[model samples]
Target: MHQVYVLKRPHVDEFLRRMGELFECVLFTASLSKYADPVADLLDKWGAFRARLFRESCVFHRGNYVKDLSRLGRDMNKLVIVDNSPASYIFHPDNAVPIASWFDDMSDRELLDLLPFFERLSKEDDIYTMLQEHKSS
Candidate 1:
């Protein structure tokens, strides 16, 4: 593969830093590790992620790569996935905290804006109910 440039989303470093302090973070993506790992290494300078899951970790279902949260051996109730792709969490939508995809918008504050919501989530005992309420509002 050729060399590629990965742009960091605005405030992503801060977001990951704060989230790491609050929760046992995991970097899960549909991307292959060969590409995603290096980018993650660059982005996660603070060692935010406890684990990094790549494409092989996902299940190919209905033409989409679905992240099987059940396979993680973690408590489902405490797990929350913050992803821009809904297909990634098709198996466990209730645990998802939907985020918009970032592009070249340097002015975007989506990641920074989600900190408060995630902070509130860190205190919650039931993720399903909180995420459902979050989706509704």
Candidate 2:
């Protein structure tokens, strides 16, 4: 099964920059129409790295909490939800492991702090190996 990584809120860019290095990242933006113009303007100013990543990514929009959870249910065991919120707050009663941010304000250094957690999760889940097998067969 393909491991699903759901990124929430402002962590979209950070998630893209970081996870893109190790995993195929699927970014769930709230609504492209809602912020398309502004986001585009920002992208023009900020540069196209994120835009490139966004283009070569899976985007899930127009979803509610229940809908998101249901989509995640298809591969709950292989899903890892990353957000800036506390893990306790983001974790549902259902099976979900959240990769919580370890800092008040997210930054490169702060994201680096999550490397250990990411390595641990990736090791435990064997997502890369599983994905390779699935792809090969």
- Candidate with top lDDT is 1
Model 2 C-alpha lDDT per residue in residues 1-137, reported as the tens digit of each score: 33333333344455445565664433333343334434544433323233222211322333332214334334555655443433222433233333444434434354455555555556666544543443254
Worst 10 residues of 1 by lDDT: 121-130
Identify the runs in model 1 with alpha carbons over 4 angstroms from their true place. Answer: none
Q: Best-fitting candidate, measured by TM-score?
A: 1
Candidate 2 has a TM-score of: 0.42
Writing each residue's lDDT as its tens digit, candidate 1 over 12-130 gives 99999999999999999999999999899999988989999999999999999999999899999899999999999999999998999988899999999989988998898877887
- Model 1, total clashes: 0
lDDT of 1: 0.92
